[model samples]
Target: MNKPFADKLRKIASYVPGEQPQCAGRIKLNANENPYPPSPRVAAALRDFDAATLAFYPDANAHRLKNALAAQNGLKASQVFVGNGSDDVLALAFQSFFCSDQPILYPDITYSFYPVWCGLFRVPYETVPLGADFRVNPRAFDRRSGGVLLPNPNAPTGIGEPLALLEDILRHNADCVVIIDEAYVDFGAESAVSLLPKYENLLIVQTASKSRSLAGLRVGWAFGSETLIGTLEAVKNSYNSYTLDAVAIEAAAASVEDDAYFRKTCKQVMDTREASAEALRALGFSILPSQANFLFATHPQKNAAELFEALRAQNIFVRYFDLPRIDNYLRITVGTDAQMARLTDALKTILS
Candidate 1:
């Protein structure tokens, strides 16, 4: 066998997702999954779906789901693009818009997949450092580049940048595409979707995975000018015509339409996040004010690495990055109140 893989893939360090442990009794907070079940409507929609539809290829365009998303976001159907997940949406966007000789710009501590996409597509990229407070300084993006992408409530840090600052970046990079990954926007962060009319270069990607509890369905979408959306659709079709399956399109549509359930679930998670932050603070953790379904915190007296192991041994799971600046911190997903209570109790025992 003559090394079947391509030369580019052989040299790439692939993106590593959080561990999905199989322990039945463990509290899973490492992947930022929603604790609540998806809306009752999602279940009903799935039940109502015709099984024979699976016998045929899913609608390559996913027009119905796109219409639902557009209605939810108050945008026209032409301004929305759907993908298997935010990851797929982002990867397609990277392929569609970032091909210039200049390097794409992103935060040094953003979703780890950014660099992986850059490598896979062979697009050059430059990482701008987050400020000492672990927030993206949008002003730093005022430079010539192929494109820009950053999470609103950035992962690992969970701190959301203000919309005003994001606008400044968009203003400076008007000629280039500015991708805003808003996976956690429904939790509390201000969505840039509202600014879509003002900045044609801006593309905002969102997911049903977080707020809608549809991670398992693998449905994500983006909002932007019709031209940007058309480009994404073209790129996605070139790769996979049926990007979203029948089950996912129906589930996501139901989730989007159930506004009351969505708002209630989001409030529950946000409430739990605040309560968990206070509990961690009482344990001597220096917590950041997060607008997402998770918290990023560091302890004054405890070693994050050792604490992570201790929690794991107790069947509690939280994400601890071994990267620079954040090695000392832990990113904990807000789970059900019971799960969070177990985590706090375990931490109390470990710290004592």
Candidate 2:
């Protein structure tokens, strides 16, 4: 610990990102990013991008991005709030909706970011344990809280809570916000967006990273009632007035409009994911049922740490965590057919 560092920053543990090895180029899959590229329209918009526009500040409200997002989700512009990325939206969300003195509730094995965000925002939270099958039990989350936040199709586990179950949880805690982080929803799971009008306290946050293949542009948005958006806007404005730049605004809006491209790519990933899951099962891995572009699996007898390293040695990168419950498992991102073939080949050889 450095003596000059602020005492507050000293105690917090930073969020660990998915590995990004420079030389692991061809079959790169660690990050759960879209294997497909963004729509051609995104590039078209970028090619015609005016250099003169950089001279002025961008729309701080990200009105263009907001409107596009609103149209796509059937929400009003005021109900949409765009941020640099979903992580930024989440960061602001922690401060805006979850800063209450009461302890927040979340699945213990959920996204690692929740705990990190809590510490970063000086918010106290309690983690509810997942049931024996490693699934989030909504009944266990029965607690008095400032709010609840979790990833649908939960990260690393790749399992989703059914809509009816989630709504029951929402009904149980109407006073506080219930945030559904649907970063990977398009892979298969139904979105909680449709439930928005019914639950004003529900905030559905999504990213352009996974399903939209625009991770580099850093676009994320949240949809809720105007009041919730108003709270987030106030927090965001105080933090950064111009979060979304001109290029990002244009690209994200254009990407949302290209439904054909997005839908096609999503279908490809889901199909490939099903094929890969079957192959993993045949090779002795127990895979969680997933509705995302990644698989959470572990070999019944093999060490996950060893498998992660073995694949990395062959330039095939995947995510492995040494935490409780998931230590034996690996989170493998869905890549193209050719990439998956190579991954399976590496696993076959290593396990042989």
Candidate 3:
């Protein structure tokens, strides 16, 4: 009897996240995490939070956090849905909008989690291959399908498509819900949130993990029409009413309120990313134009796998995917200026 249950479980392939090495003194950059500390307001909120509240259940609706996000994006409270992370919000969106016989579509080279979610929900999905330039072909999504799921400033590639192309896809698929994963949008990519008022079928999902330096808190949210958001809330409620805890609610709200800190940190990352890209180019790497906090590049003379190991030997970690079309590339996350200098210096020694 147990064998039958195990057999069913074996069919699902899970998402593999970037490596989190345990050893001390490692310059970890494989995961696209913010190298800077979170906003001062976040710290203040955490320090001031009452521990007695922990004994009681948190606000099931997360009203304060939702309202802050709504005011930021110019959406009503009813149009926003908060979750444990973007992954949780996306999972709920799949359940809410993608339970159909038709197949959903996403880029062949995109965030690895999309296919995992499709598998978990048993939602039918198709892959639309990116062009030779590693850019999503909006025209490919113009045909019939269950729905569309896209990551602006696509991971590993770190390339972003214009809003016009994204709008084209939205216009083509009016019958099904379209989800735009903007996990990297804050870096430079144009957001699909501005298009939310025009398309009820559109859903924009974002995370505080990358920009807010709050990956530890695991707060993510979505913006959409009230009807779509309500559907997600219903699905989320059916599963777990209190996805966000009291501390997360307070800290995330505080982070949002400090717009000055958010902008300053984002600018810092962007500056470092540009500087790193130049350094890699000077070392003979072909880098993509990234709008994310990471640079995707390949060296002409050095093998990517070999370079990855060489960097690891020096205790500098960057992301290397063995997947097709991306196996030759390394996705380097932008860290502090001093950290990036160390990475570039290590690469120079390795390449020599």
Candidate 4:
């Protein structure tokens, strides 16, 4: 019997997201979700929302959310593009800009979804290996390619590259589109948004998931030249005109309006992350210097797989990748002070 799916789909490997267990009393640090609650403004907006609006179709362009994002980023509304999430925006960008014969370029250990999008879009790609220190080498992407996609504070490793180096890659790839996924940029990394004026080819994609604590709302957007944004808008409209619902548009716009609360929560997470990294080091773990909300670490004396299982046994969850180069490392999201205290205590007992 023949499979209903296309032959190309059969040959592609799907991207597996982090585990999402629903068990009670589980300290979930596996997915890099914001440990803090969303801004009070979001609550207020939801309370004020009229349920009667659900009958009509939402704004196809999400103009309210786009305006808020554009104002915040010093861009015009025409220069902004909103989508269901950054993943959707990225997928569309892959299809819109990476159609050339040359393969797209990305870090070997990047967001992982990049390869999946490439596979889905039937776009050829090549992975540039990160340096021994796990930093992206700008010179490596100086050659010809279809386009470039990079996560600015790379995931799983949590190491951020300098903005100057990013500019170098942009300069090198003048003929192609360059995308900098700044999903975790709110944590501490320098954003490439400042280079927008000088480089018309750059697209900066960000999300409300991590910093705004609205992962469930599923709102993500991008900033780019009007031409690039227009292209994305055309592609998105062709696929799904109503990408964001009314509630999501209102809530996400409200999230952007409460700038003070956003900064406060981000600071809390950063503080906890530094403290947690120090605590892990005390337990003989070699922790990476992370600018993001998560810490990547490894213990020389303990197997990562065993430790992952042990943590799960204790009702604590953190991410572990069995892939090459980082098979021995664990990615631990920084939760609340109390949650991190519990995690450290568990590690103490496990190591003892």
Residue lDDT tens for model 2, 119-182 = 8788889998888787777887677898998789888888988898889899999989999999
| Per-residue lDDT of candidate 1, residues 1-352 (tens digit) | 6876666454778999988999989999999999999999999998899998789998888888999988888999999999989999999999999989999999999899898989989999999998898877777888899999989989878899889989889988998999999999999999998899999999999998999999888989999999999999888878688999989988898888899999999999999999999999998999998999999989988899999999999889899899998899999999999999999999999999
Pairs in steric clash, model 1: none
Clashing pairs in 3: none
- Per-residue accuracy of model 3 over 237-257 as CA lDDT, tens digit each: 997999999999999999999
Error of 1 at 257 (Å): 0.4
Q: For each candidate, give its TM-score against the true structure.
A: 0.97, 0.97, 0.98, 0.97
TM-score of 1: 0.97
Clash totals for all candidate models: 0, 0, 0, 0
Off by over 4 Å in 3: 1-5, 8-10
The C-alpha stretches of model 4 lying farther than 4 A from their native spots are 1-11
Ranking of models by lDDT: 3, 4, 1, 2
For each candidate in turn, give its C-alpha RMSD to the true structure in angstroms: 1.5, 1.5, 1.3, 1.4
